[model samples]
Target: MQSRTGARWEEFLGRLDRRLVSLGLVLFTLPPLVGKWVLPLTASSPSRALQAAVEAIPPEKLVFISSDWDAGTQAESRPQLTAIVRHLLKQKRKFVLFSVNSPTGPQIAQTTVEKAIKEEDLTEEQWKYGRDWANLGYKVANTPWIRTLSRSIQEAMKEDWQNTPISELEILKGVDRWGPDGQVAMLIDVTGSATIEYWYAYLTPTKVKLGLACTGVMAPEQYPYLDSGQLSGMLTGMKGAAEYFELIGAPSPELRVTMAGQSFAHLYIVLLILLGNVPIFLGWWQRRQR
Candidate 1:
């Protein structure tokens, strides 16, 4: 009778342990996906600053987006791009996209924009491709291309990515080489490369406001630019993506639930670790008493 009772207790505890870990992980991850409201995390300063800057822009002004990221860093870049695009479309801001790296950069940018538009339920009129935005596509090779663009956008980009004349694009009609009136409203760089440094050296000097979104590993490296005021705002990674989602008050099902689950899971793990350690400590205390 005593052995049976012990076995039952052990089985119960083992089952409970597994359930607690599973429940904790679910609780930690689920809110970011299904929750009606999430108290926004205050730790993501860069995303907050970026969203504030985007909100401050006039609805009519055109924003320039340089998406130099590809499949290699899609996990970070995709969400950042989605958040930015959603915000821009919501605010009715016009934008132009170009890439300094990989030939496939334009495709990735296009897909991201399209996905955001669909997800946000924005209309063609709200975020049209040719009129509200233009794609200069992959123009030149890396840093030199950025320098050329800084010197003369028109001369540097004689034709649109699709071989259309830049002059023919309604979005680019106001942009010129000389003054602020024709200048880009804001410049966004989403890249894994050092292309951002080139932008700071050449483009930011022109007084073009800049924002950045890079991978998780690159966040530390990007702080110098933010500190110097070269980058007006930034989004570091998926966490930054979630922060932006919070700011926009438009969390996707997956993100909200996942974040909640992650939080709960962390809590559960900490509890288990503490419980496990306490038993070991108690055992040591009892042995010492003997």
Candidate 2:
């Protein structure tokens, strides 16, 4: 009778374990993808700094953007790029975007721009390309390419990606000119690599204020620069992107869903960790020795 009762209890625990694992999977998977729950969102220190940096740009000053991310980091970097770009476009600030990180960076950037514009409920007549902003396209050989930009902006970027002469583009006409009195006011690098170090090494001397938007894994490498004042501000991964969306009062459910999924996934992991140690604490196998 005693043996039968013990076997039943063991079977029950086994069933409970399987159920818990299934529940964890469901918790982790659905929240970000389809969750409609309205959870509280608090912007982090870095997220706030990024918002402040973008807002501080005077209307007449031009912004230099280095878009260096590809699809692999699209989840985090894309939303961040979108939010920041929307803010810039809404503020009527002209910006020049280029990339040195990946060959496909330009195309990715173009798609993000379209998404941001679509969200604003504006028509092309209101925000035409090469008028409000321009894409310089991707350049090769990171270090030397960045150096070329700092040395002679016109020489490095003579034509927009559309092959239109940069001199003729309304947005680029007087900004980052070849001569000493250049108008490029700031640079924000949205990358998935170590390009921030290169930006600081090559572009800082030009007196262009620098900011960063990078993957969560790469963010730790940038805080030192932030501390030293080389980088004015930054945003990390999708968490950072969502924080920006919150700051700008974005109504994008897509971003909110992703953040919600991430939160639940973390909690599910913690539960798993606790469940994994249950057998050790209960001494289930240890008692078999008797």
Candidate 3:
């Protein structure tokens, strides 16, 4: 009788409604995403290192931002780019922006930068283009261009994204190269593609500090670089952005809500997996006794 009852219970458990499971997930996940609650998170070591690296850049040197991501990865990359940009602007760090992997990258980065500037409440006088920053836009030469960029900034390109002569930009006044002795303080590549390879192949051994902001899928591949000291630090996807926000003493509400939703959803899924296996385990135990 005990065995028969166990078999019947197992059959009933196997027939549990999929719709109910889906509904339960919705119940567990939706509230957090829609709510204003932001769970506190500790900043990871990589995040701290990235922030420290940026801070370590000398005041007079320019930070090179190679934004190589487009809308396809915006949900993750946008926040990463924005957080770094906000940090740079807030610290009054002069920088330059450009894209080589994606034609749309520069435009998207520009939008993110503008958003950051507005959020930081910076004035035109405080953060003017051609002085505080410059947009070199997108270039297509890839390896060759980067090789040229390594040797001479003046020879690599002559115009900004707006077609304005690079010579007219006060930001590039004395900037002529990128190396240990160059005017570039550090090169930060914010990308979702494999473009970092170009930097590694052509630019890594130059003694310039390098950083990366990449998607979650790309994060694992970059760990070796971090471990080997080829990279100064990294910000991986949305979670990385959130960690950065924490390090900067500014938590993003949107990230807080999104993270809470993901956390709850993950927990719910794990619980369901454990519960789903219980009936099978009990059935096996009953059969063993028989």
Candidate 4:
């Protein structure tokens, strides 16, 4: 009778062991998949920060945007750029956009703006180009040009993206040429490179408020700027994009849904790890009893 009881106990332990392992595997693999359903995971905070920055932009003022990203960073940069432009458009702020890195920077910037416009259901007249905003397009290379432009906007950008002179743009009419007091209301830098450092050197001293949005991996490098208040705010990665979406009260279905899956996946793996550990503990305790 005692021997039969021992055999039954061993069989129960074996079943439990198998069940725990199976549960562990499922937990490890399932969260990321289910995380898709978890809307608004880690992006909420950064999105609010960006929204606050946008709200702070004075009415009818022109903001300066340095767009230094290309197709390679579209996964991160695109959504950030979209959110920023959406805020600017909603607030009716005028802006001047320029790019330093890729030749396609201007095109990408235009696409970002257009995408926002479409998503927001805004008409062209409501946020007209050349009037509401202007694209200086891809001008010169980095740092040196940024410094030179900080000193003299006219000299820095002789013509607009379409080859139209800045002097000829209706939106730029009567705007003080980029001189010392002729500072922009704000400066937004969205880039995939460390070119942000150059803006800090050349433009920050001018007292133009600055905001930044970069790829996920670039966020760590930007913490110093945020701590020093050199950057008024920032957005990092797809999570940041989702947060910005929420802040605008225009969350994209695809982004929110995808983030949910990621969040769930993380939780699932954590639970599975704990579950798997329980069996090992029990097994070890049983062996020590012998």
Candidate 5:
């Protein structure tokens, strides 16, 4: 009779396990997908450091941004770029954008800037393209390209995205040459791949301050650069982007919702694991009573 009872409990638990799994999935899925919950925001130190570094650059200073991420990393890299661009635009700080690794990188960065300006309702006179900003578009993205660019900006990039002479662009006013002493106040790389390595290996010795925003996977391995002082600050993955959103004082509901989904998924998995072990616990309890 006891053996039969155990079998019954096992069967019931099997069914219960299946039901719990389904229930947990539903609970975790719906709220975030619908953006139904509000969660507290906490900005990590690295993210805050990133914002501080960018903010330290004076409005008169021009920043050089390397948009090394393609569409594959849009969810994370886009927000980082958008938030950074929005901040730069707001501060009236001019910046030049270029892409090294990906062909679509330049266009993606441009789109993000446009979206940011639109979202902020910025006026043409305030953040005018070609005057306040210039997109140098794509170029050879390797050690040799880096050497060429660092050696001479004019030789490396002669034209803008529209094929107009970069010499005529108003945004190139301060940047007659390359390196930290010229128009570039800093260099920021928002990348999804190994492109930051090139920046570190090539650009570190230059006077230009460097910063990074990369996917979570690449972030761990890249910490050594930070330790080596090659990277002034860094942002990692979607979490990093969300933290940046916090820093910019523009918290994104979509990001919060996604974070909620992630949190709930983890909790649900833990609950399922505990519940799955319940049958064994119950069996042990039964033996103790016997």
Candidate 6:
């Protein structure tokens, strides 16, 4: 009878229906995603520094945004781009958008720009295309191509994304080249890959300040660049995007929901860890009492 009871107890403790577990997880996680529960996040130094660097950009020269991420990394990269672009637009700064890493990056960036513009509620007269910004589209960013780009923007990109002559774009009027003495004030590369390495290797000496917004997995390797002054600033990942939102004084409801869901999921994992170990611990304690 003792052995049978033990078997019954084991069955109760050791087996859980998979569907029930799935349902429990969904129930546990969905509220935070759907509601306003958000974990408070303080802006880190890197995020702070990035915001300051962007703020310090001269109004006359244009900002070059190398939107180099595709849909795969949009979860992090899109927020980062939106935050920075929104800030730029709010400041009435002119910038050029393009992609060198992914073909779809430019399209994603264009969408992000439109979203920012709509959020700002700016009219066509206030923020018209070809005057405020231009999308130069995607290009092959090989070392030689980057080298040429560092020298002459006109030579590297002859036409805009719509196939219009770049020469006619009012935004690119004086932007014939890139460097400290040239038209672009700064270059911020938002990417998931090591595409920044091309710029770091080939275009580092031009005194055109570089910024990076990269995925979490790709962040650690680039910190040395920030510390060494090769990077003006950086946004590390989704957390970085949240911190940026804080700095800009615009809380993102979607990001808040996402972070809260992540926090609850982490708590669930901790709960699982405790549950998995408590039985063994209790067994050890009972044996010791014997």
Please name the candidate that would achieve the greatest lDDT relative to the true structure: 3
Which prediction has more favorable lDDT, 2 or 4? 2
Tens-digit per-residue lDDT, 1-290, candidate 5 = 34555677667766675666678688777877686675787887778877888898867778888999898998888888887787777666788999888888999888888888888788766678889888999887767778878766777888988798988898785365545566676889988888877777766666677889888888889778777777878888888888888888888888877767766877888976776666676678878888
Off by over 4 Å in 4: 1-36, 42-47, 176-180, 260-290
Model 3 misplaced regions, further than 4 Å: 1-28, 268-290
The lDDT for every candidate, in the order shown, is 0.76, 0.79, 0.86, 0.75, 0.80, 0.85
Candidate scoring better on lDDT of 2 and 5: 5
State in Å the error of residue 90, model 6.
1.5
Q: Which stretches of candidate 6 lie over 4 Å from their true place?
A: 1-27, 268-290
Estimate, for each residue in 1-290, the C-alpha lDDT of model 2 and write its tens digit: 23444555556666776776777688677855764765677888888887888788777788888899999888888988997888787777778788888889999999888778878887777888888888988888456766787887877888877788898888887565421246777889889887777778887887677889899989988888888878888888888888887788775677777777777877888877776555554565546755
**Candidate 2 — which residues are off by over 4 angstroms?**
1-27, 177-181, 272-290
Q: State, as a TM-score between 0 and 1, how close model 1 is to the true structure.
A: 0.73
Cα error, candidate 3, residue 287 (Å): 7.4
Q: What is the lDDT of candidate 3?
A: 0.86
Candidates 1 and 6 compared by lDDT, better number: 6
Ranked candidates (TM-score, high to low)? 3, 6, 2, 5, 4, 1
TM-score of 2: 0.82
Q: Please give me the total number of clashing residue pairs in predicted model 2.
A: 1
Worst 10 residues of 1 by lDDT: 1-10
- How do the residues 1-290 of candidate 1 rate in per-residue lDDT, one tens digit apiece? 22444455456556676766666666665665465444446537788889988887767667888898899988668888888888887787888889987689998898888888888787767767778888888966656766788877887887777889998998887576522555566888888776787788887767778899887778899898888887889987767777787788876555544445555656767876775555455556656777
Location of the lowest summed lDDT over 10 successive residues in candidate 6: 1-10
